[model samples]
Target: MLHKWILAAFVSLLGTSSLLADETTQARCVVDDKRRQICLDHPAQRIATLSPGATELMFAAGGGDQVVAVVTFSDYPPEAQAIESLGSLTRLDMEKLISLQPDLVIAWVTGNPAEQMERLEALGLKVFYLEPRRFADVSSTLLRLAHLAGSDDVGQQVAQAFEEGINNLQQRYQNASPVRVFYQVWNDPIMSVNHEHLIHQVIELCGGDNVFADLPRMIPRLDTESILSANPEAILAGGMGEENQAWLDHWQQYPHLHATADQNLYFIPPSLIQRPTPRLLQGAERFCQALDEARAKRQ
Candidate 1:
């Protein structure tokens, strides 16, 4: 399901590659706990982000003007959707990437495959890998991107706004009501966010209990029976679109679920929840307001 060249293209971008031009500033890199790498300098203005998260960071950093191309999966901020579609994260069009001639390429090291990174290296493309494991790291990464894009001012503004939203939510939810929420990311079987993840962090921020908090993966497969047992007061379905209306609406048959029985299930765009970009703060604030109103009505 994953394309190999995507990884090649990214690895080629980071450091010590032929494309690594002699820059004015000495190159600096930091390897995260996941052993993933990122480039802090020599940022290209004509950038091409190859994954959703990178796209989010670029937009947050005010580097959208520099984004020459983006992947098919990047649809948020509306402006990003206008870029040339390079293809899916897993299925990169190598020729298209090369032909686009972007000065910088960003990739999700964790999402991309080994072979692909190697190929990009062989071709001498400058790739920056963004591997985010926690919520706070998203802002840190955005700062790095902001510096790269020469938009430190915009990045600061965005970061401040996001942090303010988070602080306000924490204050609002502290020592107060906590909603029992089932945040479903996917469902053929079922899937949910984990405790160490940003999505879970967002849920917790909203004064909601993540039904699958005990699960240990960022996005883990779950069982429907567990949902029946957890009996979440509300179901916040992520990745919802027109195609899933029929499927999500079926929760009605599950009489045990408070979400289903009372029709409390809600489908907000995945971008609002899943994206760790600055926009998520707005998303969180607005969604929490709705949740607060819903809880008050129920009480």
Candidate 2:
């Protein structure tokens, strides 16, 4: 009877040990922006980011130290520059990326080359895609990335802060008078965003109406005639570089235009508004302030 009891106790201990190991190695899964489920046997320890935006989001998700590889133009948070580069967003050095032995890769849905991503998957590498089209999407991305990186606590905090910042902006400008505005995305082709684009949402959040919001394409090439016909009250532009106001200067030739006439041509830094990250709150604040100034001019 004593021997039987001792054997039973040993079996019980073995079962408990197996259960604990299973808990530690439990699979984690998250659906990427592509709506495909990505499952990992355990939280990723090494991560590679394929785009500048992906790099920024990974850092925001508290996986900065785990970032083993990054592509060119990933120059945010200032520390990202120190990471090893695989090359530009359009072209990646696949051999170098494979040599890093990243357990997970953060890819851009529309920005990255699909063939390269496919090759990674074929080699048994896990890849997660991201494309944040809305403010809520950004928060969700933070949480998802953190889940994959085993930094859920930090992700939750940063996501909450970003959501609160955007909410504060929405409350501040919800009732302001609408300002007709034209946002110039590029000067060469004179590109403007439509309602489907994120920038247009920012314009609406600030109680402003986008002059080209009705355009068919997300980024529509425009002519001087269409812009003059709209005659927007405010013109906001992000030039080739931060603080390069040369794009705004081109509008000076059209003195008859309301935006030029009222001196409502505002130059916004490209990175702030262009990248869909936590910093968008800063861009929203600047955009709202610009609209407020335009409103003040009416008085």
TM per candidate comes to 0.81, 0.89
* Model 2 agreement with the true structure over 3-57: per-residue lDDT tens digits: 3432343234224443355466755677788877777777788999999888998
Please identify model 1 stretches exceeding 4 Å from their true place: 1-43, 242-247, 297-299
How well is each residue in 13-132 modelled by candidate 1, as lDDT tens digits? 334532343344645443333445645455457888888768878987889899988887787778888889878888888888888887677777667665786788678776767765
> All candidates' lDDT scores?
0.70, 0.86
